[model samples]
Target chain A: MATLGEAKQMILDPAIRDWVLLPIMVVMLLVGVLRHHITVLITGTPKKPQLKAVRESKALMRGSQLRAFRNAIPPHAFASRKAFLTEAYDQGKYLKNPNAPKEGVPAPNPMTDPDMMEGMMEGMKKQVTNMVPQMLIMGWINFFFQGFVVIKLPFPLTLRFKSMLQSGVDTRDMDVTWVSSLSWYFLNLFGLSSVFTLILGDNNGNILYILGLHHYNEPIY
Target chain B: MARLDFEAASLELQQYRQSGERASERVAYLASRIIKDGYSAKLKDDIWPFYEQAVTAALDVGDFRLADECIENLKRRFSSSSRVQRLVGMRYEAEGKLADAQKIYDAILEEDESNILVSKRQIALLKLRGLKSEAISALVTYLDTYYSDAEAWIELCSLYLSVHAYQKAAYCLEELILLQAANPIWHLKYAEIMYTLGDYSLALKQYCRVIDLHEDHLRAMYGIQLCASKILDNGEADGTTEALKELATERILATEVNQCTIDSIKQVVREYLSVA
Candidate 1:
C-alpha cells in the first residue's frame, strides 16, 4: 500500500557519536554519582522518636500481638490483658495528649509545624537536585545534537514509538529503530542505573525510577 | 605504674569455675582496675553484664566492699534505669536484707508496673522469702502482662513442679514445645514430663521425635528403651506402636559401639527387659 523508496536514509556522522552520544552518557553518569553524595549529605543523622511516642506505638503493637496470639497464652492471662488494653484504649490513656478533647480535633497544619516544614524543604531539595541536572543535560543534547539519529536500537519498534524515538526529526517514514539523540539520552537516563549501582552501592542507583514513582504517587491537588 | 589489663582480667575470670575467696579477690582486683582506668569503649558496652557478674562473684566471696562499689557506680550512671534498680534489689538480697530488697522491687513496680526485669526479681525475692503462693501469683501476673518471655515460662514450670502440680508443669512444657517446635531440648523435656505423668505411649512418641530431631541423643535412647518396655508390659501397644518399639530396640542395639557407655546401656536394656 506504500511506496517502496519513501523511507529516508541519513548517514550518521562519526563525530556525533564521539561528541554527542558518549559525552551525554558520561555527563549523566557523573551527575548520578554526584547526586547520590549530595543526597546523603543533605539528609543528616535521623532524630530519635520521643519515649512517650515509642511507648504508645509499642502498646498498640502489644495489643495486636495479644489478639493474634491469644491461644498461645492462658485464658486468664488473655482475659486480663484484653480487659486492661480495652480499658486503656477506651479511656484514651495512651494518647499523646490524653487531656486534649478528642472531638473537634483540628487537621494538622503542615505550614505551622517546623518538623513538617523541614520535611517538605528536604523533599523540595531532592526534587530540585533530581530535576536541575536532568533539564540541563536534555537542553544541551537538544541544542547541540538536533536532527541527528545518534544510534540505532537492535530491536525493531512499532510506529506508535515514532514520536518518542524521532523527537527532533520530522520524517515519518524513518525506521523506528533509529533513535534521535534526545531519545538516546532518555534511554541512558533510565538504563544506566545498573552501571551507577556498580560504581556506587545499591542504595545510590535508580534515581529516575524513584523520581517516576514519586511523580506517580503525587497528590492531585 | 603498670597499665590496667581488662583482657587479662576477663580471661582470668573465664578460667575460674568456682566462686570462692580467691575468685572474689580476683573480681575485686578487676573492679578496682576498672574504676581506676575509667571507662573504655569495651567497658562502656559491657559494663552492665561485667558489673552484674562481678557483684555476684564478690558476694559469693564475701567481698561486700567491691559489690557495694559496683552497685554505687551503676546507680550513679543509670539513676532511673529499672535494670539498675533490679541489680540494687539483688545487692540487698545478697546482703541478707530481704525486706529492703522487697521495698526496692515494690518501688520499681510502682513506677513501671510492666517492667519485666523488676517483676522477675520481685517474684524471685518472694520465692526466696519462702512465700510460694505469693511467688506463684506474682509470676502469673507477670506472665499475663509479658507472656512471650520463655525464661519466665520455664521458671513457672519449675515452680509448678516444686508444688507437685504435675498437670500444670506438663501444660507449661506443652506451651514451651509449641513455642519452640524446632528445639529438640523442649521435646526431650516434654517427653520427661509425659513420662512422669505416666503417659508412656505419648512419652515414647516424644522420645522418638527427639531422636529424629537430634540423632544419637543418649538420654532419648534410654527414654525410648524404658517407654518401649513399659508399653510391652502393659500390652497396650497396637501393631504400629509395636513395630515402632521393635524398631527403637533394634536402633538402640545397633548404635555405634563407641557412641555410648556400653556397660551402662546394656544394664538399662537388661533392667527394662527383666521388668517386662
Candidate 2:
C-alpha cells in the first residue's frame, strides 16, 4: 500500500516550460486552426441531391407525417392516403432504381459502387488529414523533450495515472501529480478544447482530440 | 440576405397597394434582371425562392408574359419538378383553361402522389370550380399529411363554416388552438364557435383567455358581454361570470375614452345594463 507523505517540492527548470510546455500547446493550437481552415476548404458548398432522391425522401416523410397526424383528417382521406402510400412502398415506385433486385438477394459489393467509393475516399481523406499532423507532433515532442517532468497538476491523481502522466519518465516513486513533457502534450490536447471552440465555433475542437486518440490506439504505419 | 431583400420588397409591395400594377411591374423587372445576371456559386441556393416570388408577383399583376418567362426559366432549371409543374398549372388556371390546369395537376399527382404543393393547388382549383365537397375532402387529405400547416387548418375551418358545419369548424379551431396556444386569434375564433354552439360558460372562459393574451380586444369584450347575459338569462350566473361581465364593460368603456367613440360605447353599455 502506498502511504501519503508530506508534499515534495521539486523545482521545474524554466526552460522546460518555455521550450516544451508552451511550444507543445502553441503547436497544437496552430495545427487545430489550420485543420479547421483545411476542412472548410475541402467541404466547400454542398452539392445538391438528385431530384429523384429528393422526391423519394420527401414522399417517405409525407407518408410518416400522415401516419403521425392521421386524426387531423377525415376517415375517407386517411384511408385513400394509406392505401396509396402502401401500394407505392410495396411496388417501390419512388425508388431510384425500381427494377433493382428485391429483398433476400445478396447485398451489392460496396467496392463496385461509385457512390460508395466516393464515400470511402472522403473518409480516407478525413482520416489522413487527422492522423498525419498528430503523428508528426507526437514524434517531435518525443524527440526534443524526452524524459523531462514538465509540470505538476494542482490535483493529485491515482497510481493508475502514473504510467500515463509520467510517460517518457520511468522513475517508479515519482508522484502521479508530476507529469512528463509528453503527458503534458496529451493534457493540452484534451484541455484546450474549450479555447478552440471559442475560436472556431463548436464543431472543430473535438476532432483534434479524437484524432489524438486514434493515433494513440493504432500506431500509424 | 437575398431572401431578406425579397421579403422587404414583398412588404413594400403590400404598402403600395393602390399602385399594385406599377409595384408589380418593378418587381417583375428586378426579377428579370436577377434571372438574367444569374447566380454566382455562393448564391445558387437562393435563386429558387427569388424566382418563385417574382413569378407569383408577376401573375398577381396580370403579366402573363413575364410569368410565362419566369416559369420557363424555372422549368429549365428544375426539369420535371412538381413545384414548377404546379406553377404551370397556375398559368393555365389564370388563362381560363381550367381543364388544362386540372389535367396538369392530375398528371403531377399521378406521377408523385405525395406532392403536397400540387395537392393544395388541386384543392384550390376544385374550390374555384365550385366543387366544394371535393375541395373539402382534398383539404382534409392534405391536412392529414401536413397537419402542422396552421394556414390550412384556418382554411379548413372557414370551409366548414361556409357549409354550415359548426361542429366541424369548432373541431378545426380546437386543433389550431392545440397547435398554437399562444396565438390569441385561434382562441377568439374558438370562443366564437363556442358562442354559436350556445356553450356560454366555455365561450366566456375562452373570451377571457383572449383578453389575457391581447388586451383591449373589442370583439372579445363583446363576446364576454353576450356570454355573460346569456348565462344570466339561464339563471346559472356564477360570481366569475358576473366579474367577467363587469371587467369587459370596464375595458369597453376604457377603449371608448381612448378612441372617442363615446356615443356607441354609451349605447352598448345601456344595452348591457338593461340586460343585467
Give me the candidate number with maximum DockQ: 2
Clashes of each: 0, 0
lDDT of 2 by residue, A50-126 (tens): 54666567567767767676654445546876898899889987776789998899999999998788778776777
Query: How much lDDT does each candidate structure score?
Result: 0.74, 0.76
TM-score of each: 0.53, 0.54
True contacts kept of each: 0.00, 0.00
Encode model 1's per-residue lDDT on A1-109: one tens digit a residue. Answer: 2443544455678888898878888998888888888777877545544435555665676677666656544465468768988999899766666786667888677
- Kindly give the stretch of ten consecutive residues in candidate 1 chain B with the minimal lDDT sum: B13-22
Report the error of model 2 at residue B35, Å: 7.8
For model 1, what is the alpha-carbon lDDT of residue B77?
81
> Per-residue alpha-carbon lDDT of model 1 for B1-276, expressed as tens digits?
788777877666555533433466667677667766874346644676677767776776777887888778778888887777777788888888999999999998787665666768888988998898889888877665555567877888999989989878877766565456567887888788889989898888889889888987878877887887788779887777667666666666667345556787777865664454
Give candidate 2 regions above 4 Å deviation: A1-221, B1-45, B260-276
RMSD of each: 11.9, 11.4
Estimate candidate 1's alpha-carbon lDDT, on a 0 to 1 scale: 0.74
Error of 1 at B99 (Å): 0.9
